[model samples]
Target: MFTRNGVWAIISKDKIKDFFHRFKSFHIIVFFVIFAVGVLPCFILSRGIVANYESRAIEQRIVNIKTQCEIIINQMGMSEYLDEPSSEVINAQLTQLANFYDGRIMVIDKDYNIVKDTFSMNTGKTIVSEEVINCFKGIENSRYDKVNNYIEQAVCIEHSVTKKIIGVMLISVSTDSIVDSIDILMTKAYILQLALSLAIVVVAFYVSRRLSRPFAKISDDIAEMSEGFLNEEISVKSYREMELIVKSINKMINRMKVLDNSRQEFVSNVSHELKTPITSMKVLADSLLMQEEAPVELYKEFMTDIVEEIDRESKIIEDLLSLVKMDKTSQNLNIMPVNLNELLELILKRLQPIAAKRNIELLFESFRPVTAEIDDVKITLVISNLVENAIKYNVDNGWVHVSLNADHKFFYVTVEDSGIGIPKKSQEYIFERFYRVDKSHSREIGGTGLGLAITRNAVLLHRGTIKVSSEENKGTTFTVRIPLSYIAS
Candidate 1:
């Protein structure tokens, strides 16, 4: 269904499109810029040279004709040339000068009559134009008409002894020879321009192509990455800019890998945590149903176990909801002034009962009376969570010391616990959602593993910081520094 002409047309259209696309490319843009910068001045200079030559040639021809006309006019003024009007000596000199430059000379008297015309076309003719009248007024003038390609000069003739104006000598010279020379110069200049333009084109093409090769390599590397070859590192170091681009892309790749791992881990942890309570409930229910008319005491015990499992599930879901809420609450905060000392005291008071269960002591100390702008509810959660974790993870009869201090700009809360310490490796990830230091111990302690993550988020929302430092069996200390006035990021 295709003809050769149609196929050729299609190929030509595609080539045109690709050619324009290349013009839009970075290297092609560079090429055209360099080419223009190189060629434009040469073109301007060529035209300038031609124009200058034409001007100077026309001017020199005018000067020579004017000089010869002045001499003849002076000789005639001393003799009886104007009265005679056709002297052989004057006419001969005028005719010869006119023939030399391929021009014409006219002698006009005071009465505006052409007394002598070299060409003999307008001899004895009366002329009354502005130029001849002005020359009789003793004003000498010259004009070059480029459109007519001729130069005309009006020289006022003066008497030799009296220095009074007698007549005007008008000279006209054809510029055909100057024009021909200019045409030849233009032709040569055009040839030179073409040669230089071709050379510049070659240089532009080579330099632009060579300079863009590294970028082309970078583009190919990124394309390969898009095709799922992410494990390979982009390594174009030919240019510093390319090197920086490669480094940035490689850094992004590494970050993506980290986020990918984090996502997979989060999903696995969620599935396991949600399934755990259901499994325990299923086991308890099955055990009860397997009994043939189980006793009331046994049923009550099984129901209590089931209820505990349900509570555990509810707590996990609640913590997951809080973690999800943290991601969206950076822009929304019910900020207000609250007494930090009172808030810490209230947190310790509420957590005292939990500490009492483990025979752990809760101590609160305030270095100064501190008031700060904060979201009371979120700040309460952050403080209570840290203090509660301190209480929960403590050794029997251990102590939790909460101290509050403040300066002109910020308030600091420090919760130190004498409890099981975190390993250096695990400390780095303690704030990550669903990350636990010791799985068995975390489960026994009934942690949803999202407390510290939520705590970190709350602190960050307030434009504050929380840091933990600990050693094995040496306990842990969490220090929170919050600004006196909340500043929105």
Candidate 2:
């Protein structure tokens, strides 16, 4: 394609394909246009120049011939035999002139009668026409004609000296010299044109290669990037637009690196989290069966505990699946205003009996109502996990406190417990899936380590934030802050 200023534009492969498929070979048609624009004019100009050059050369040759004939006529008229000459003498002179000039020469008398003929005087040969007879009345006539399909010409001149006409001399000129000159010029033009065309083709090929190189590099780099080669960087020596593309690609590669790290952390944490419940269920089952004389009521309690463990396992599996779904696809959210106080109240109520069995007091303290736009199910999961963890990890006679507060733009919730706190270093890793600050303690307390990670993901889905404040042996508090306006709905 050509721009308004006459610069050629590179055609993309998809565009070329589209042209062939829908627009009937549009790019191919443009190839001819380029040839016409760049090459045809050169050929046309060369032809005109060669034609003018040949014309000048032929004109110079004609002038030279006329000069030679005038010099010869001056010499002939100044001779003593100018008035009358014998047939033998005239024939001999004509023959000598014909041999010297590489042509046929004839002398005509003043009466327009042929006195000496160069060719044989034979019957059934080319005859002198009325035009030749009339030529005696004219000064001169010269032109080229085809005789026997070969180039030949006649040049007739009235021989004169000092304004006195003597006779007419006719010369049969050979056009071989002119034809040879034209042929040489035409051959040179063809050779020059061929060289120029080859140069253009070579330059065009180099330009096409240079233009396509960057795109080829980009394609290879992207293919590697997609295959999880996050460190792959694109390097393209190209124009500004291509550089911009490389910059964008580098940014995407950095993002993929972060995502890959997050994914690995998530997988590691989930595996450790799921292993806890499975180990607990196995140990508890073994312990219950080892009693030779187990009480019927105790066996029933153990069976109920096993059922609860199975339910917890099922919930963990469901949560894992939900996370996978959210990661891989886009889904519509069920958004609504969820009252943080009410939600926490329900979660605490559900966990109270468990806390009571452990001799841990469950407490609630909230003066302000907290409401935010959220997905109710995911929000419930976040609150429920926090409360469950607080109860499970509490000290004997220790208290678990829940609080709520809100502002015009945000709502905040906190869950605090008197339990062994996370270390400063371990707190940073707490929200990573399957991460455990105290793995043995978590297993003993029937804790699946995925609780905090799942809570974080749920809060993130609501465009919210979560933070932990804790010190070893000083207890821990989990705070969740969510925006009031941006809800899943």
Candidate 3:
């Protein structure tokens, strides 16, 4: 039952609301600026121009009427009409002038008696108004009534020869013509202003759209990326700010992709690692179960193998839990001041037995006394992993060196070992979770492949850096640098 206009109105309202919701900021600013700078000023200027025109028109009308009054005054004086009060020539002139201007005229003698009336309504009457009295004293006066649309002027008539006042001439003229012209001008100006306002609105909308288009594109790109469609970078180059935003967003997306891939790989590796141990344990269990009356020594051997597999599985799970905990503890570092030399000594002491079992000599040398603010437990884990790996990978009778040095800002620890070193290409990926240069060797050595990764995360959490240098058959050295003081960000 709706009319076409009503339906259109509803649709238009909905569209406006949608636009406001989408680009409210830019639209609000653009509309306000256009109205304040364009439409509002145009309206004020139009009103000012109309007012000036009306003022000039009123002045011109007053001048024309005064000129006619002066001409009539001269004629009346020369023909002695003011004294006689019955001159047909002067009265006819006055009546014609009044009729032409759609007004009335009156001629008053020195004693304030009306000598001639253009309308013939106040003849033979004595007038005692202020304007007439002031006119007799040689003062000319005028008054304009805008609401009534009229103007009145009072002038003194002088004797032509003696230059003495003889009578007062008062002319009252209608201002309807001037007012009508002004009204017409204002109407046209208002129409023009309305047209300009519409144009301004169009321009404002266009400007707002252009300004907001880049952000809209960015939003779309982000949405696509969220839906796993991030094969390329966002290329919104309309503005410098948009370019920066796009670059930052693209970087973040790339990082997220890398993390996602790493996560997938880590999960697969965990399953494989856990399954291998469980498989071994199952085989060992089956071997014992199949032999009902197995020898005590044989049973003990099988049980030991099963316990070893269980231990390996437990180690893998524990490392995974440690990695998860480290990820969560990135921001919550329990920082305290500790002696770096003492901390390294303690780690080496704990790892000395493992190194001795492999006949690897453990040596520690402190170049300078060093104290730094760090998380004690995490730092201990980092150093322990490094020194332990060095010891584990060392040859028999090989030496492992642990050294510490310090400067004004930072302290350094170097752990070097005469061990089978990593490949040059593999060094870059050593800190990646579950990465191993030789899977069989790693298994034989009982490495979970999560040690270096945990070490790197712990060092990074303390705002430190660790670097590794190695050769194929020579040795590997890990250098660690940590700041002397903890500065929380």
Candidate 4:
């Protein structure tokens, strides 16, 4: 449904976009900049100088010829050249002046009668014209006719004693030499401009290529890395900006290498964990099958062991599923304004029975009535996991304290427990999936080791932070901060 103008506009826009995409290169940009900076001023200056020379040359020549005409007119007034009409001295002077300038002169007396002509064709002729008429009225006049390439001047002749207008001298001088000189100058200027432009092009090409060479090499290296060569580093150190780019890209490469290794380890760990329970179930089944007449109580006990192994396998799979869901939450968040105080109280109430079994105390405190924008289910899971972990890992009769507070921008949740705290060496990795500080103790407590990882991921999805400070055999504190307003990524 596009109008004609709209279709043409789209076509022109696409053409311009395609042109820029094809020619988008540092070398092309630099080359144009250098050529512009170096050559445009030189061109303008050469044209200006040529034009100025043409004008000044014509003007000076006219002034010189006019001075000569004035002197000759004065000489005629002092002598009888106009009356006699054949004075040899004045006639020779006029002829010499005309020959020197390659021009014509006409001396016209009062009453519009031509007394003498240098070319001799207009002698004794009546010549009435604008310049001649104005000159007789005591006003001098001169003009340049560029199209005809000549200078015309009209001067008044006055008697020496009377100072009255007696005659007029009309001078027409050729400016052909000045034009010829200008033509030669224009040719030379154009030649100079062409040579300068050529030099600028050469220098622009060389410099732009030199500057862009390192980026080309870096691009090749990055292309290689994209094909599973992440271990290699890009080593371009030509310019300061190049060094900074290399540093940033190398850091990203290191992070990518770490991520790849983590993925490999995760796959290995999953296979081993999944196989262990199946192997145990097979061993128990083999033992039961080997007995020819196994007792009912013994079969029940063996079957119980198998059921526990299956439950363990199922738990591991469930936790893995939870982790996978946490990883893909970009579009799955059911965000709403949730009251932090009530959410924390409900989590503590739910975990209270588990804590009671351990003879551990569960407590909740609210510094202020806190509310924030968050996914209620995810945040509920996060708090439940932290409090439950605190209870499971704590000492008998130990107290687990949960506190909620808020500021103008964010709400804070703190869980402090008198638990067998994590060792400093293992603290950094506590949030990694399936990682355990004390593997044997973790198994005894039936921990799947995905709780903290899930908690951390959920917090991150809400653009929040979680930190832990622990001293072994003393106590541990986990602090979480989340903004009151949800900002989607």
Candidate 5:
């Protein structure tokens, strides 16, 4: 829809709809309003400026005519002569004036009869044309209007000395030259506007696509994720802030994946852990009842087995409670400066008896003394878990090596064993709670599977990093790196 202007303009409905869609409807309306106020006014003002120039040209011509007529009248004093020689003399003066000014001149008697006409007699053309007749009748005063083959026009009055109407002067200037100039200016303006509008549209389209492309990609990624593709990540190439947003989204997806896996593992581990002891108790009870006369020795042995199963179940419950506490951030580490090398010495001394029972050769190797600020109790638990796993998994006379080293920034502790190594596929998930590389072996070795998970959490609390390297039937190495100070310089 358009409002009333001096002149109406046409626009296509599809163009309007497209503009409204590209920009908002409200903005498009405002744009049109501004275009009307700016461009339309300029077009109208240009036309007015052209008209003013024409009017000034016409007015200047009239003034020129009046000045020429005044000079002629001053030279040849006005006198009404009734004789032919006097008339001829006055007519000659009028003829000279007409030739000089490029206009038509006529001599009239007191009764307003044309005695002599200059252009008509000189050029042998009729002076009584419709326009000339109108001028003689005093109806036209050299009216400046458009004429074919003319560039400009003017008309002026030739009055009698007594202030009575004597004759009218008509001067015509060709306007074709000026009209051509104006048409050229109009064409140039149209071309310039077309070029500018095309440039604006191109720039707008480019910027919109550049800004909206990343978001469109992100939208597509989200659609894929919604279809059970949680492994997929949204990738974007943009500025740092845009990258940060994309990073945050991907991190959230990873956390959800971890949580889902944790939940499934938790349920399976809990059911399996509970079922083992319960099934053992049931079997033992059933076997005892099958003997009608149970021996005293057999009864004591069965009771002892039941007590051990109960203890095992209780320990599992306690480990679960500890995991819950760790999950909730309820376990706070009392950190202090502790000599890591000295701490390793204590752990090795305590595990030596268990190593001897398994006939495993235990060794501690330290390149240098390394000190770090850590919680002694938590670190001890981490060491204990690693050593216990080494003892449990090793064959008779297998070797376990514990070592310590330090760099300028971080302290490193490593534990390695010549036991059955973890598979490459399982290394990535070994630290996850209740994840077992070999389910049957894990049961035989009596692992609750929460040990490594808790150890990882403790190391993280100390702002440390842990990594595992292993190959089947070779050896497994666990390395932990911790900063020497809580605040690294």
Candidate 6:
């Protein structure tokens, strides 16, 4: 039986496996860089140092041997040794030098006869070689054979009094001791390289984990958000890059949440607005059917009320359709240059009778002639909605003023009305769909509550701004500024 803790352990192991699998390529690249930069260089440098050390050691030994040969030649006096060859002191010195170097030494006279041999085997023999010949001609020479592990040196035996070469001293020494010393150094170097390689591997693993940890956290947070756990923000701020990613993700989440809430509110508002009229018509129809002996006037009045409800329902649906069309993100605009003054005049002409019903004055003032690129149908609807609302909500005998003007880059329209203005707090949400400042008054005036929403969306589509200034119970003013050209982005 698996417990909760055991199940969580399995999930954690799976996450770890996924993390490594995702970053396997990165980890491999990091390891390769560490080996190339740290281990490979160390190995090459150590090998070069060992070879150099061996070479220098051999040169120093050769120098010492050459000095000893010169001293012996001076003590014996090259002419005297060549004539007699019987100096016990010089012989003893040659023997001691050969033993110290662990090799053979021979002294040859000008006639190529071995006058002295430290090994005692080549004594009284004739020695001929290129090194010895070169030495006698005043050219010193040395040879080191790495494969055979030996060094051979030839130095001239010059007489101290005459300072002239007479014979040659040949020394051949085994390089086994130098080779042994190098072997020790190479072994130590190999051990050091192994330790350094291990360190590099450890550091590579640590750095890779630290760098990938933020991505892993982001992945987990996104997964949790997908599972409907989005009440909290993603807070991964380990690195600068991660901080930017987290901030962007949080902003997207907020936008999605707002859209979701707006969608729910819109649906609820649509249901209520549609149901109210149908219910009213149903009540009126039931009343007519209940009165079997009703008079002609009563029947006509009930039928008129039902017809009015149907018309109100129809208006709401038409406004809803307009809003839905405006809400489409990819809707195309039928853009054209429109005369702003004429458009306002036509809108005022249509609303004149409605203003006349309340004895309110409808006026239009044009500061300058203006033409602008706009979607005619949508913009007409926007202007009409604002003016219609102004007339509908105005006090009796109050004035509704519509004005038009133009600037270098933009055209402006203002709609001011002597009406019951919106509350300060309600003005902020006036453009929201189905929002009403006075719900009972809105119903009495047959307001659909979608007029300002449609107006705002239309203005925004034209790359314009709308601002409302109002004080409750005094009046309201709406100013619109739109660009002269339509540039599709």
Best by TM-score: 3
**Residue clash pairs of candidate 2:** 269-433, 269-434, 270-434, 335-489
Task: Encode model 5's per-residue lDDT on 1-489: one tens digit a residue.
Answer: 346432243345666777768765333444555555546656666667767776676567566666766655443334443113256655676666666555566543334344445656533223445555565455554555475533222222344465544443344444454567667766776676667556555555565566666777777888888897745688989878878999999999889888988788788879888789889988988899999999989989998888888887887787777677666763556778998888999999999999999799999999998888888887897888888887877778899999899999898888999988999999999887778888888876777787888888878877899999988887789998888877432
Worst 10 residues of 6 by lDDT: 23-32
- How many clashing pairs does model 1 include? 0
Q: For residues 286-341, could you state the per-residue lDDT of candidate 6 as single tens digits? A: 98889899899998998898898999999999999999898784368999999888
User: How displaced is residue 409 in candidate 4, in Å?
Assistant: 7.7
Better of 1 and 6 by TM-score: 6
Q: Candidate 4, TM-score vs. the true structure? A: 0.81
Q: Name the lDDT of candidate 1.
A: 0.89
- For all candidates in order, the CA lDDT equals 0.89, 0.70, 0.88, 0.89, 0.71, 0.88
Q: Give the number of the best model, judged by lDDT.
A: 4
Q: What is the number of residue pairs that collide in model 6?
A: 0
Q: What residue runs in model 2 are displaced by over 4 Å at the alpha carbon?
A: 1-183, 199-315, 318-330, 352-367, 397-401, 487-489
Tens digits of per-residue lDDT for model 1, 223-307: 9888987567888969777788789989999899899998899989999999998999999999999999999999999999899
Measured on C-alpha atoms, candidate 5 has an lDDT of: 0.71
**Local accuracy of candidate 3 as per-residue lDDT tens digits, 1-489:** 469889999999999999888655765676668667878889999999999998899899989998888887887767688889677777778889999999999889998899788888999999999999998888999989988999999988988888899999989999999999998999999899999999988887787778778877888888887787867877887888778878888888789879999889888899998899999989988988898898999989988988988899998898888889999988889898998888888888888889889788999999999989999999898989899889878788999999999899988989998999999999999998888899998888898999999999988887889999999778999999989998787
CA displacement after TM-score superposition, residue 235 of candidate 4 (Å): 4.1
Model 6: which residue pairs collide?
Answer: none
What digit string (tens of lDDT, one per residue) describes model 2 on residues 112-213?
Answer: 555555764521233365445445455365554533212222334434445455556666656566668778998999999888777766665565556566
- Model 2 is weakest, by summed lDDT over 10 consecutive residues, at 146-155
Structural similarity to truth (TM-score) of each candidate: 0.75, 0.56, 0.83, 0.81, 0.54, 0.82
What overall lDDT, based on C-alpha atoms, would model 3 receive against the true structure?
Answer: 0.88
Once superposed on the true structure, which residue ranges of model 4 sit more than 4 Å away at CA? Answer: 1-13, 20-24, 67-71, 137-139, 214-218, 228-230, 238-264, 286-299, 330-376, 395-418, 459-467, 477-489
Clash pairs detected, candidate 3: none
Q: Identify the superior model by lDDT, candidate 5 or candidate 6.
A: 6
